[model samples]
Target chain A: MISPELQAHLQSVIPSSSRAALRTSVLPALLTGVARVASTLRAAQHVSLAGTANAFGDDQLNVDVAAEKDIRAALAACGTVVTASSEEDPVEKPVVHQDGITKGESQETYTLAFDPLDGSSIIAPNWSVGAIFGVWDGESALHQDPKTRQVVSILGVFGPRTTAIVAVRTDDAPPACFEVGFGDQGKQTWELMRAHVQLSRPPFKARYFAPANLRSAGEDARYMALVTHYISERYNLRYSGGLVPDVAHALTKGHGVYVNPVTAGSRAKLRKLYELFPVALVVECAGGRAVDPATGEDLLARPLEEWDERAGLVCGTAEEVDLVKEKLLG
Target chain B: MISPELQAHLQSVIPSSSRAALRTSVLPALLTGVARVASTLRAAQHVSLAGTANAFGDDQLNVDVAAEKDIRAALAACGTVVTASSEEDPVEKPVVHQDGITKGESQETYTLAFDPLDGSSIIAPNWSVGAIFGVWDGESALHQDPKTRQVVSILGVFGPRTTAIVAVRTDDAPPACFEVGFGDQGKQTWELMRAHVQLSRPPFKARYFAPANLRSAGEDARYMALVTHYISERYNLRYSGGLVPDVAHALTKGHGVYVNPVTAGSRAKLRKLYELFPVALVVECAGGRAVDPATGEDLLARPLEEWDERAGLVCGTAEEVDLVKEKLLG
Candidate 1:
């Protein structure tokens, strides 16, 4: 049950030139589709350890494969999406026009990069798992600058509630980030929960820290130093092994830093195109900073890696990211 | 929709002597009551900040107060609970018998202590929160060691799924801990998801860390050393700021250690009667260890604190808990 209220919100946030097509056709199709996926993921209790390995060495859980297949099938059903690529299957695949006979007025096509299950390593815990999707205009997401072309970021959280931290970015207006919930369990209805979302930084009580890849501290002195700094600073610790929840925690708390540094010895484990891009889009839209840990360059501004490239990221409150960059990279 | 399957399970695990009464009357009513409460909590999107402060001087949220009230009302309505205590309002309150005309045959009266909302500090983030309850057969919890007196522990988790880690500790037979789910959202049904839950420790690949109260590390060198040890040992990190989820994660994931130490400079913040006792019951029932971080005493062996006495706890996989105790308490 997609809400008319959210449809109205899409109208206000999207540029007026494409309002008619996007509001009525494109975004609604995607929102409803993702909501359904979130619902399906929520109802599941996934624990099977015997599943085929993906292109990566990580063994794909049954739920991971199912999520990817579900997202692909969902995107295909929408017909508005031009292309999609997922973490389990990173190759870009095209979406067909399923609503051929019922097609409406012309609208910009969307190329989506998604991690159907962002935190499979942490999934078995029956803790909170999530789905991350990045929406861009045109046929491909290969070299596009995420900041300009990335139209939306849908972060589906499978926590107590099937909630999402969604962002709508338009060239004319500022990017909008809101928290929305899928209606009652087993129901398809969607409701707009928080109208606006922002990150809490210094001088605010919402301060916390999510230190990912702590193993890297053994190899990188700077990573160790930064962690020591956070401890000494008394940053409340909140590092769930899952990526979506870690970043989303900072956003919902309106404070904190999700810092995963990739030093030479550490090497990167999180794929840039699927995991980082979508998360960074959502973070930046929430008035936070999503930057490369080493150079502090805006991650969305950097050209995405071609095939399953992994890297480090610093995202959350703008000030905290800056502090991480200064201390971690130095 | 309470499944006949779980009710059947209740009968099998509960001691045969009290089986009929507990299965037919007391436990069912309590389980149903908690299921409804979990459902109500899952549906809510709590962010209200204005509320009264609890005895601990921490600002309580409206949701916190409401949860306490709801649990009290539910317990009163159940009519089998003779006495109860709560974290928000730590006083022991007597529950009035409501089923006078419909009262069943002889059954044991139960006493309960609960932290209705355990992770309110992390609630603003829209992250996972939980409910912890400890049940005793006798009238009072004062001076009694939780291990023998604590008959059951209901660890209600408000995650994507309305779930619980329920432990029924019986002296006559082996204690049983199982994971159960509340039926679909908006439905009052219940389902048993997992029959057995055990923790993963040294020999398992599911090792993880949930470092609560890292603020104490600045004042305590032992804690800082423990953190460094975890990083170097490459334990996967998973410390959400919520206790219910953190402890529940260990039970669900079959691994992980949630260590919070109270030092000379860093005072304890978790209440022993409600928070630690309830959580310890669940952890121990899952074959894990729950202990005082300082003396390494079995936490369940300690007597209940009359008021909301705060202390440190180290809980989870047996090997991990022992490792934490040696490293952090040394």
Candidate 2:
């Protein structure tokens, strides 16, 4: 059910060896699975509870559980995913073989880590939420540099419209990003919204900022100064309390910087493999930068080892990211 | 075309004298028109512009212009809307009569003021944006107490779902809020999602904060203290750079406070007619409080005589708003 354009796209950016598997099962399963998450959220929002809290984060709202189940099921059915992890489960699990038709362990085989639902804390308010996926070319997500092994990153945004920003990498060409949308009456079809998406490009002076962990400002004076600097210089504020939407805003504007600085008082909470890696890959592929705020090194340079590995991030348009590192990290 | 439940709702909240008009024209036109805004935004997000700033603001994106035309046209066709205004075109203008049948200049003849597309600055990133409308029962939105004259307030949220938080105030009963979704294969019909929506109620300590104009903290010490207090107390952050979504989040969470303070250094930018008043009515109806950040008076108590009346607002759960006032204003 994929369009020819998307078909051609997967062929070019994904390694030639993995193209058939991607076309046959991987991408279809991924997109369709995320679409189901959208429907589940829409349906969940409808069930009203008067005098009840409007939020879903504290106890893993049913929507979170449903998103994991739906996306996990979609991937497991592909039979190409040999191993997978989720923000919810975290433990690497062998996706149960359902169809009994499994692919041999090869470079074409994939490993995945996903935050089935990100920013659930804000969902009760019906603010936008998202799902993050990082896909590796081989069976395990460990002991490998994501810059070379991680082939795909997809961020599915749950907002007024259901959309996903897909980033792909190939040794042959510069990594690129694409925007796809879920629509059509049945809410099942995935249509290409834009191809070759990129962050705000050259001659770019910083324009927008998504500053997370503002609470850290109270703990760290430099953090507070950084916040003031942005205002004094007049950078547009776009913090949405969600990693995917915040970075996605930069990917959408092709300009902007996102900084989640780690202070001794406010340790960084974004998990590397599930949360940060996928988003970092996507932003980098879109002609932006993603780095550890502490060292300002490439975020992808780090291997996925610890299941709960967390890091502070400064990512987005390369120039703005540089400014963030100089002002805060330096 | 209206559902029995909605029809019944209108019959009760709207005066008996205006019931037939609301049922026949007002609500239908308003809902359908906002649905069009959702569609326009979705469509606009698709027309990708690479290498361009990922934003539709500054000079007014095409989406903003298109939204005003669509909603204004829909309202004008009802022939019952005598005067209308928009954040885009702030001057009050007569919605030219489109239909031959016009309602008499009675209480049923409505007045509307809308921010056709609120938070357009953030829309470029595919983040959620919204429409805010205040509907009065008579010809002018001026010289009237929005607490009473503003009979209906609709907050249209454009996100993974196209939904609205509608608040109605009637002399006969307590004000109440409702949530509705736009769906079905056609994206034309409105279905009840939840009824009698309210903010988090009794024994509630605030859980969320939408801090707008945080840049003001640089200018005012109290503003900085307020941000620190919220952080120290660990108020969940729910800001999305949009007034409607920020306030809607509070309404949905059933508990939260949103504060946009005006310091000697930073003047208020939210207009009374298009943004503040409508949201105030809805929050109040939902058992929340919306007050001027400085004076701590009922926002609706002020008359809407000025077209561009800007006010600093502290709204949401009553107790949290009080905390904000005490910490900063006092």
What TM-score does model 1 achieve against the real structure? 0.93
Residue B290 CA displacement from its true place in model 1, Å: 1.2
lDDT at residue B243 of model 1 (Cα atoms) = 87
Clashes per candidate (backbone, < 3 Å): 11, 12
**lDDT value for candidate 1?**
0.75
Which residue runs does candidate 1 get wrong by more than 4 Å?
A2-5, A97-107, A186-189, B2-4, B55-57, B99-105, B186-189
DockQ of 2: 0.44
lDDT of 1 by residue, B216-329 (tens): 888888898998888888777788878888888778778888998888877788888888888888888888889999789988887865676668889988888888878976
Question: DockQ: which candidate is best?
Answer: 1
Task: Give the alpha carbon lDDT tens digit for every residue of A1-330 in model 1.
Answer: 667776666667775776455555556655655566655655665457555887777787777776776776666555456777777777787765555523222566778888887777656555677888888788788878777888888888876666788888877777899887766564556777788888754697646888888888877888899999988887888887788888878887788888888887777788888888888888888888998887779888777757766678899888888888889765
What would the per-residue lDDT of candidate 2 be over residues A1-330, giving only the tens digit for each residue? 566676677666665664567656777788887887877776664533233222222356677778888898788678777788888777777777676657543446888888888986667667788999988877788888888998888999887677899987866556878988777434345677778788866665547788888777777777778877887676767788889999888887778888899998877788899888999889888888999988889899979776678899999888888888888867
For model 2, what is the error of residue A34's alpha carbon versus the real structure, in angstroms, after optimal superposition? Answer: 2.9
What TM-score does each of the candidates earn?
A: 0.93, 0.86
- What are the TM values for chain B, all candidates? 0.93, 0.91
Quote the lDDT for A83 in model 2: 81
Native contacts recovered, each model: 0.54, 0.46
